[model samples]
Target: MEGTIKKLGQTEIYRGSRVHLVTETIQFPNGKRAEWELIQHPGAAAVIPVDADGKIIMVRQYRNATDGWTLEIPAGCLDHPGEDPLECACRELEEETGHQAKKMDFLYKFYSSIGICDEIIHIYVARDLVKTEQSLDEDEFVTVEHHSLDALLEMCFQGVIMDNKTISALLAYRYKYKL
Candidate 1:
């Protein structure tokens, strides 16, 4: 069974320069209806930059949503429309962590929340890092951190690292590389 979207009622619960509030009415196949509150976003890109020593260049940042500092991979949103995700990843990595990757590899894409919003996240891996100067976004507050592969994996198991995109990508990389 399937039903079409009869109507959507959304109000700006909160608005900011970057993101906005959204609430929509979704009608289901069985005449059931529900409301969804979503954060309107322009999608994002996460980069896992690896150093020559096989360590991952991560970041320690305060996430307002999480109410604390989180250890996460360098990531950023697409400010320019039609900009490539790989380019965004490379740029974010360099800007946030002061490292540029010689090789950028596309691993996979995922949705942060499929229930309400249409935000898609592209995950990429960057290797052969080169030291560079950070050029962080004006509104962004981030601190760079580098972690050994073993320590990073341990953090994942201990739930110390709380970024879902980073965790998923690291796991996938381990599985793919058979590490």
Candidate 2:
């Protein structure tokens, strides 16, 4: 179990601001050799901010990868290696939605794309929100919106909320709060 797979070698194919692509040569436990195209990621944190009125704060922003707008929870990548995921969630919540959380409870973590990427996103439920000024990146243009938890869940089922992190986080929150 300890050394099931051995990395024989790896070649960096591309390096970008958020991710890097690499081709890895791996030796499996049964002596099978294979080449895997892996997308290296720094990880991220996502927050479902629930305010006093039982509404979840969300953001609608244009995603270049999809060439369209997406409704998603506040999320951001780890600013640097080893950064605390909870802190990142809190920062992203305020920066994206102009809301500061007094309490942040961890829900779960998952890989966004298990087949080709190693991007682990830590999800949390942020409660007791306080209003603040949003601090978005220079290129970020987001519209903050609040929706009922049930509505968000319906959106998830209706395929309106396509962001994996948002859908997962909303389901987790619903289970945790029985909403």
Candidate 3:
């Protein structure tokens, strides 16, 4: 089948360090046209750092959008265009959790918010980690937390972990490996 929607043009409304806002003019297959506002993102990578005892290292931080704290897997956007996702994951793991992974296994990648944003999140499981010093960004204030895989699975089920990427990665890891 042919592509369903054709993008006629896009106008930039705003641009920020992490995301940009734009209005896109699209023509539907039914010959109808509409303008849609969307946030464009550079994409990101997240890592689930698992220690030798099988505890996953997580990060807790306050989110401005949510106006509250969130527990999530260590994640960050690609430093520049064409940066490898695995590299980003490894860097983020060490920066957020002070653990460098000796074994990085990619789990999956998906569009976290396909409706209003074009952000793709790559997920990985990091193991055989070595202790290191955390190198958080100047603006980042993250606290490291560790928990068992089963505990995280329960948190996901109980809606305690609300971050989409964290939930997705946890569920995917749990079922993918039959944990």
Candidate no. 1 TM-score: 0.86
Q: Give per-residue CA lDDT, model 3, range 58-152, as digits (tens).
A: 99999998899999999999988789999999999999999898899999999989999998899999999999999999999999998998899
Per-model TM-score versus the true fold: 0.86, 0.95, 0.96
Residue 98 of model 3 has an lDDT of 90
lDDT by residue (tens digit), candidate 1, 43-156: 889988888888888888888899999999888888756778888888889899998888888889999888766668899989988899989778678888778877888999
Better of 1 and 3 by lDDT: 3
Q: Give candidate 3's error at residue 80 in angstroms.
A: 1.4
Instruction: Quote the lDDT for 148 in model 2.
Output: 93
Off by over 4 Å in 2: 1-3
What C-alpha lDDT, on a 0 to 100 scale, does residue 160 get in candidate 3? 88
Instruction: Report residue 66 deviation for candidate 3 (angstroms).
Output: 1.6
For model 1 the local lDDT of residue 30 reads 71
Q: Can you tell me which runs of candidate 1 are displaced by over 4 Å?
A: 1-12, 138-141
